[model samples]
Target: MIIDCIDKYELYQGLGDGVSKALEFLVSHDLEALSIGKHEIDGQCVYALVSEYETKPADSSFFERHELYVDVQYVVRGEESIGYAPLQDQVVVKPYHEEHDYALHSGNASFVNLCGGMFAIFFPGDLHMPGISDVPGSVRKIVVKVKA
Candidate 1:
């Protein structure tokens, strides 16, 4: 997992070639102007999903891990918290949905708060429970899905 400001995104471009492409797309575009939907950059190789919604409680969200993609999540308009835990000893609550590329797991997670301009990158082995906030509020975020 990597958490930092987009201003320093260039430092972690070393995450991979695809991550570099994803960061480039983010810096070159106006995310606030993007409508709520999936925007493709490199066919299925890279894409961003713009979402706006109210935040939920931690217990209400599930810890999910993806096998096919690395997530580059950025908050554009609000603050939210995300739970992260290594999947090493976790038990699956719901088996993986190959079509969706994720599986839900039951385990303890550490929470992190992110406001506008902040981003977090979760790799395949990183279990994440997103959309939780300290207080219920609306958040507009873009999750860039980069093929792993």
Candidate 2:
């Protein structure tokens, strides 16, 4: 997992071609102007999903892992705490669904607060629980899916 400002995206460019492409998209485009829906970049290989929703309590959500994609989640508006845990010794609450590329897990995790303009990268082995907060609040986030 990696968390940093969008401007520092170049530092992580070497992670992979897809990751670099995702970072480039985050930095190069006007995320706030994007509509709330999927935006294509590299077809199925890479794309961004713009979504807005109310934050939920941490306990109400479970950690999720993706086998086929690395998620580059950027907060465009408002702030929220995201939970992260290493994908080890965790039990799956729900099996993986290949079409969605995700599986749910229940485990302890550390939380990071991300405000506008911040982003976090979740690799395949990173279990992440997003949309977490102590109090409910609106958040607009762009999640770039990079094929792993």
Tell me each candidate's TM-score. 0.96, 0.97
lDDT of 1 by residue, 30-114 (tens): 8889999999988899999999999998877789899999999989988999999988888899999989999999888899999
Encode model 2's per-residue lDDT on 5-52: one tens digit a residue: 987888998999999999899888988899999999999999999999
Residue 23 of model 2 has an lDDT of 89
**Clashing pairs for predicted structure model 2, backbone only:** none
Poorly placed runs, candidate 2 (over 4 Å): none
lDDT of 1 at 65: 91
Report lDDT (CA) for all predictions: 0.91, 0.94
